[model samples]
Target: MTEPTDLTPSGRLPVTIEEEMRSSYLAYAMSVIVSRALPDVRDGLKPVHRRILYAMRESGFTADKPYRKSARAVGDVMGKYHPHGDSSIYDAMVRMAQHWSMRVKLIDGQGNFGSVDGDSPAAMRYTEARLAKASSFLLDDIERDTVDFQPNYDESENEPKVLPAVFPNLLVNGAAGIAVGMATNIPTHNPGEVIDATLAMIANPAIELDELMQIIPGPDFPTGGIIMGRSGIRRAYETGRGSIPVRARAEIEEIRKDRQAIIITEIPYQVNKATLQEKIADLVRSKEIEGISDIRDESDRSGMRVVIELKRDATPDVVLNQLYRFTQLQTSFSANMLALDDGKPRTMGLKDILEAFLRFREEVILRRARFDLNKARDRGHLLVGLVLAVANIDEVIALIRAAPDAATARESLMAREWDASEVVPLLELIHDEGNVIIDGKVRLTEAQARGILELRLQRLTGLEREKIQGELGEVAQKIGELLAIIESRPRRMEVMREELLAARAEVATPRVTEISDALGDQTDESLIEPGQMVVTITRDGFIKRTPLEVFRSQNRG
Candidate 1:
């Protein structure tokens, strides 16, 4: 073998291990940030999510289409787009189908898709799925080239860089993921509220965060609960990070004579109800909490009802407060609104996120219009060629007959000049740049010439000629509208607003979590019933209390 060449051809360059590690780690972190952990501010999807939706769409698993096997979808996504594990892709698909997970579900599942109780979904083979109706908001204009696409990992397929989402899905559906050194946990909001706020921002771009908050007071979890205060919500909306306390909605009900029970109707967002009940039971058994007789889940198909039976003398309010303090029934949802904006990780406030989405939507609309405009112009150009062929029918026929072969005929047709009088208005209407008018004459392009040769003898009739003009007129009108949309910014904004409102009408539901001004961590002393008690104090610093009703009643004569 030849003498060993230098590690570097010119010189042996050395890099410290620390530097190499740092660079390698940074690359990994960025990959997770861009491809796995964070969602795009525009479409509110990470790479896996976007791929799954796109693949399902390509396979014809739309809202109107019948449900297909979940395994089939997972296989298609993994093979074509997402090269990750099947379980990860299937889990993402299941979450999108879960109503309790996504505020507006992207998938419409036909089988068991996990639960708020923290149960895992059945395997992909046992389930079925299709895109949800509201998913159309994100996928409708995709075929019109509204978004950019990039090659897959193996370059065997192409996937969208981001979806052309019409609604503010980032806020409406929320997101949660953990990357290398950073993580994001955004809370879901009411679709109606998010849409209304987006419209407000569009109408007045200068609106402050506080004004926007008026339209969207706080997050609305799928599982109905109560948000205790506004301070945390305000902080999260303004700074993109905060913790909001949520409590179970409970009521004191007298099941029998003097015994009362706490009926929990809803739990905090993301808190496992089964775990919460177990914790409550543990508290009672360990004697950490004093006032409890029994605990049982009376929840059914109608609604959730966790009944905590109280002893004869136990105060229901005091016991409820203890449960809230000790169990997951009252939990704090930590909001970290970190997302990928322009391929960079950004912790964005409410206004920043909405504005980014609006800008992206404007770009998508403009690009789609341009794509349509190009198609319309191409059609009009071909129509002009057909019109020319029909007008000079005999000359064209004679030329074709004289040619020795098809190639010669095509060249001869393109070589001659045709009168531009009849189709000049149609060309101008479509802004057809393909057909150039020079000195009151136009030369047929190879494409137009080919189209003329392909035309049948029947198209040379009077009715066919009239049909061609009518079709060209329609194409011209479409071109004009598309041009108007592309040229005017305010018109695009109007279209965005209209589309958003329509989506809101379809997906908006009542706010499940109720917001209150009262603090969640207040003492339970206020819950104690007002009464008189006899107190006895010992010299050793011990004290005891007895209800006034414990003493015998007396009458004064």
Candidate 2:
């Protein structure tokens, strides 16, 4: 601590270069670890992602557990892995596991998080939960040295930066996160297919993004919505990013056990579960949902039970139109996935991402060649062949060194050609290849022999070397593409954009002027002039806007 006289008014202490560097670096590291890398119990946000999946396997939150309040589950997460506030924890727990809540729900919530809308939970004591099947699968290999774990803030807890998340959690469960200059928004996938794709990747890390599609297919949203087109998924993965189009499952359901009506099984992936409900409530209050007899959150522990019970004999198509007309259920997800390149974050399209990954993989291959024991052994064996030829150099020189009467060394070796025994005449009586190499005065060691062979091989500059590099590069690209795809966000609501656009365009058609060639009538888009429009909005709910044409109309009317 410097004295007040030596320090400025800001209580500054002279920091050395080392201290400055160390402090600055540590601060950055902590920022990544605490805020970005680690998951918060409140929002279920890890530095890597905000979305999470929970299991309702056995100890799962059941409607039966004496109706344990939702608060209990939230409390457990807060006290354990996450130390955020209870409200945050509860919210995360509910959102992740709620069936009727998320369009592409991650968690398999067994108990209740409250209403499908933004309603608060009954109480902390009402809900309960356990590890989910998918969650357990994701965590299975955690202790196998397949993944890394770090200490918590107080060193009292440990968290896996990644779950060994074998199933491409980013894609399977979908994730959303905001880091310093980056964000991730990956969509959820079908559990079974995700597992298959993961297994495929592990079996041959060299698989292409296109190949992965065969295994995982497109996003298998929990809400069962439609992924209009999957062609962009490959490009997105290849480029480290791309958008997907998602849409709701609009099905005609029976009303009052008689008339047919449309029932929305899934909403847009981007719309918040809480926000969607509020919009629904507002519509009901506004009497815009005239045909809706009741909108009850029938979704219980078993499955999604969003019951939009309708009035008798209402047209289901019209109801669906109304839903699209006013709600968050129809939306768009803009994908801008970014991944690590050269140890730094970089935004990329699907193809670019794949290319970067491939390059990274090639580097790995080169590194392995220099490090892996088995590879080194194979390389050393090749050098043994070269040393055999070099040891007999003396005989060749003798033929050239002497007159024409001298014997030809080529004939001697040629006689033994195509057979290992041919070298026996030149090799003394050594059973081992190395013994002969030493006896012939080559003075070769295993490591040195391997090194020389490697240099020679690298100098080949031929098709074989290219083939090897190509294999390595391909693998690297595949892995990166997989990770990026998983780490990337999915576009769930994009499919309905054209529909929404057409609707909006119709609403904004600005009554175009047309010469009804016969009548030659003129038309205006709006009843009131842009500047002459006068609005009188009332707190009691009445809204009045003065029309511009009224001023020009005859006073007699």
Best candidate, lDDT = 1
When summed lDDT is taken over every stretch of 10 residues in candidate 2, the lowest stretch is 511-520
Tens digit per residue, CA lDDT, model 2, 266-296: 6665555556666777887898776766666
User: Evaluated with TM-score, which candidate comes out highest?
Assistant: 1
Model 2: lDDT equals: 0.46
Clashing pairs in 1: none
> Which lDDT values do the candidates have, in the order given?
0.90, 0.46
Candidate 1 C-alpha lDDT tens digits along 1-557:
78865377668676789999999999998898888999999999988888889998999999988999999999999999888899999999999988778888999998889877889999889999999998888899899999998898998778899999999899999999999889999999999999999999999999999899999999999887899999999999999999999999999999999999999999887788888888988899999887789989887878888999999988777788888888887889999999999999999999999999989989998999999999998898999899889999999999999999999999999999999897788788888889888999999999999999999989988999999989999999999989899999998898888888898889989888899898899576744555898787889999987777663352222
